[model samples]
Target: MIRSAYSLQAAEAEIPALSATPLDVVALLAQAHHPEAGAVVLFSGEVRNHNQGQDVDYLEYEAHEAMAEKMIAEIINDAHAKWPLKIAVAQHRTGKVAIGETAVIVITSSAHRHEAYEANQYIIHRIKHEATIWKCEYFTDGSKKWGGNCSCCPPAL
Candidate 1:
């Protein structure tokens, strides 16, 4: 098996866990700042007003909290294995989220722009596709769909 390019253990993150409260993007970004890191990247996954042909009113998320957090931490570790990072963090919200609200955020910092960008992308993608989190969309049309598992962004207007 191929090992990490940098063998340093990933620092235990206080982020990368499920949140019942709003995700604090600014605070997480601040925490990701590091003197050694020349580039910091952040991806915010927000709740949108629509999806597919439905006019969405709001969203509700649920998760097996412990399992989701453990998976996210492992994703962060995988990102560390691929890139030499100064900081890496991710968090997702559970319960109700209104339109224009942020549901998830991932932050990464590295010595170069490329590493930070790629690692941040990797973390968010893995979290969306692999985490135990689930989303339910409530449409203004009075219908609801129970699975859009990813915290997807609003499509262009």
Candidate 2:
């Protein structure tokens, strides 16, 4: 099956853990499906309690969202440019999120499992590596720090 859909949102809400519901993602994939597609692949990035040995209490995300969405749209365009994708959608949450909550979701569909798998990976990698965004880590000790902006963080692609 070959379908067409894309979505992105940044919200302040309680993030789900363990078994989270990505309604937007589900809906997008449902739209993306085509009778010819045999597989769908989805990638979700969740909040974890530890980073670089630091105990994270929570996370605060900030974005120039209008531009961020534009860039995200570009990633989707690039993925489709590079792969045989039937459908693709990417959504990310912003604001305060606790440990073990979903932060991002990338879903891709294709005629075969391999295309879906590769497209999903490409979406996530681009989101992390190229997306114009920043995050701050809040620790149990009341310390806060920025990530993705510091040279200590991984280099941008």
Candidate 3:
């Protein structure tokens, strides 16, 4: 069942390891192109230098590769089931990502702007909550901490 779904020509998903190079948004956009689709939404999650009032130097991302890929594929498949999407592609980076570098990319195409936008949002949100990707923040003050998500970090006390 998974093999058949993965064989589709329009869908693309990847979990690039530490040795792999950085993500290319243009390339990912190109991969999501579908002739019938009128709208394409692209999203990139980048690493930043500050978090919760702390000075962050960088972030290291680690994923259970096989499970991560499987979860991502499932998420994309779920998106297709929910909307009339032409194609969807998402890629996440593993290992150390410097400040200003992209950590993840998501592209979704559909016949209209609304579907494309909603699907894109849904994909990204689901990936954040569902994927087994762990993050460790390296602070400039020589401290490191783990387990807080980029979007929902706890407020400084």
Best by TM-score: 1
Q: Write the per-residue lDDT of candidate 1 for residues 1-157, one digit (tens) a residue.
A: 1133222123335454888988878877777777678999999999989898789999999999999989998988888888998778888999999999899998888999999998988888778778898899999988999986544643311
TM-score of 2: 0.75
Candidate 2, 1-157: lDDT as tens digits = 1122222221111222112233354554455555556887877677778777778998877777777777788888788788877667777767787788767887777888988898887777777666766788998888898884333334322
Expressed as tens digits, the lDDT of each residue in 12-124 for candidate 3 is: 64433222468887877777766677999999999989998999999998889889888888888898899998778788888889999889998888889899998888888
For each candidate in the order shown, give its overall lDDT on alpha carbons: 0.82, 0.67, 0.79
| Candidate 3 residue pairs in backbone clash | none
TM-score of 3: 0.84
How does each model score on TM-score? 0.86, 0.75, 0.84
**Colliding pairs, model 1:** none
Runs of candidate 1 with Cα error greater than 4 angstroms are 1-12, 149-157
Candidate closer to the true structure by lDDT (higher is better), 1 or 2: 1
1 versus 3: better lDDT goes to: 1
